[model samples]
Target: MKLLLTSGGITNNSIYNELVDMLDKPITDSNVLCIPTAMYGHPWVGPGVKAWKFISGKEENPMVNLGWKSVGVLELTALPTIDKDRWVPLVQEIDVLLVSGGDALYLSYWMKQSGLAELLPSLKAVYIGMSAGSMVMAPTVGEYFIGWTPPDDSDEALGLVEFSIFPHLNHESLPGNTLKAAEKWAASLKGPGYAMDDQTAIKVIDDTAEVISEGYWKLFQT
Candidate 1:
């Protein structure tokens, strides 16, 4: 699977272009399924209008609003009750999976529980992740980003990529998420990490990872 991980969604033209490149097709021709499970786990962003905005493309972050040929929701928490034959084929057929921003660990947990995490490696679709969605691709999100706790009481994520991410770097509203704070967070990680602002995104295809940014970002090499 290809990955386009962003702090904010496709906020700028640079990131949007990168997303198109990853798709290898026009956004208008694409079939999309958005995963809004992450929002429900977040205290401030969840189980309410915020999730609706994200699904309806009314949220500030642009994901579902990109004018795809079709858009559907894949709520991870609801997957277990249904049979795999129903949704599995749909997942494989989709061109893109738009994951929302919220609580990373909670998203990670549902991904595992819903069988999406196991199915991701075999998928041919592009995976676009915003905020917590991006963070869940890492091995661990670190304690600082931890909000909703998993049953196992671990910070472990999907580990789809080698490096971790510190998102929303230096945004005015999130005063605590400064570069210095990100640097400190990166120092505690065991592997390479990135601190990226809203306008920055990381694109990954197989083993290659590239930074596509209109804003600032720092790579902390371990």
Candidate 2:
């Protein structure tokens, strides 16, 4: 039940140190598995590689350069046709599961359809979610009403936490990702929610959640 849900990847020392501490071993000794399946929801460009690049074309992926002994990407969409036995072993060996951000609904779709939601709880690794990745771990995604599509028609989540996470708050690059917009979205939800900017993260261990950040964030309750 160790989870480091972040608005973005390890952006500063606070988050980097937190992750190092969570690993309990030297950073270089860890094995990380990156999942970019959420990117599937975005508009397809050309080939499969191009579509992947479209979602992750930014600078270096944080997980790959996090000093882990090895980093691998698991395209969860391929799970439907691949043998579970193979992927399950790969999942078990990782020290961390780094979930990338894109469309939250798309990520949840594969997680549910591929049985990842159920399998994650049993894994001993730390779960690190960024943006859309962070949002899907909540009891519900709530109504985003932003660039990404709201969680499917049902608007549910993996139920990993009691409340929802509204990430990328006040992020200048993402239009409409302001505090006012976040508050409006949070108010629409039936339960509690947290609005986090790029420098903030919510670390959840079992039922407890601690805010770790060097920047701004807000917690809203009904």
Candidate 3:
């Protein structure tokens, strides 16, 4: 799977161009499915209009609004009750998976339960993750970003990527997301990590990973 891990969504031209390059086609010709299940588990972003805004492309983050040929919602919470054959083909046919930001563990839990995690390795679609969505690809989110707890009460995630992420670094709204705090967060990690602002994104194709940024980012190695 191709991975476009972002702190915020496609907030700048660099990130946008990277996504287009990954797709290898015009945005207007692509099919996209957005996973909004993560929002419901977050206290500040959940179970309300925020989810609607994200799906409808009214949210500030540019995911579903990217002028795709078709856009659909893949609600992880509802997958367990449905037949796999019904949705699996749709997932396989899509060009991209737009994962929204919220609670990382919660998204991880549902992704596992919904059987999406198992299929991730072989999927051909590009996986675009925003904030917690991106963090879920890491081995663990660390205690600092833990919000909703899973059944085992662990910070463990999908482990698709080697390093962890500390998002929204130095953003005005999130005062605690300063570089100092990010440094402390990086210290608690077992492997390497990145502290990136909204304007930065990490693009991973196979084993190669590259940083595409318009603002700033720091890589902290343990």
Show pairs that collide, candidate 1.
none
**lDDT (Cα, 0-100) at 69 in candidate 3:** 93
lDDT of each: 0.94, 0.79, 0.93
Per-residue CA lDDT of candidate 3, range 1-222, in tens? Answer: 999999999999999999999996799999899999899999988889999999999999888898999999999999999999999999988899999999999999999999999999899999999999999999999878988889898889999999999999999889999989998889989999999999999999987889999999999999
Task: Give the count of colliding residue pairs in each prediction.
Answer: 0, 0, 0
TM-scores of the models, in the given order? 0.98, 0.90, 0.98
Model number with the top lDDT: 1
Pick by TM-score: 1 or 2, better one: 1
What tens digits encode model 2's per-residue C-alpha lDDT throughout 1-222?
589999878888898888887776787888778888776675532236743552443434354456677777787888989989989888876788888877777788789888788899888899999877888887777766333454447667788888899888887778888888888889888889999888998888877999999999999997
Model 1, stretches more than 4 Å misplaced?
none
What's the lDDT for residue 163 in model 2? 82
Pairs that collide in candidate 2 are none
Better of 1 and 2 by lDDT: 1
- C-alpha RMSD values across all candidates: 0.8, 2.7, 0.7
Candidate 3 positional error at 96, Å = 0.6
Candidate number that wins on TM-score, 2 or 3: 3
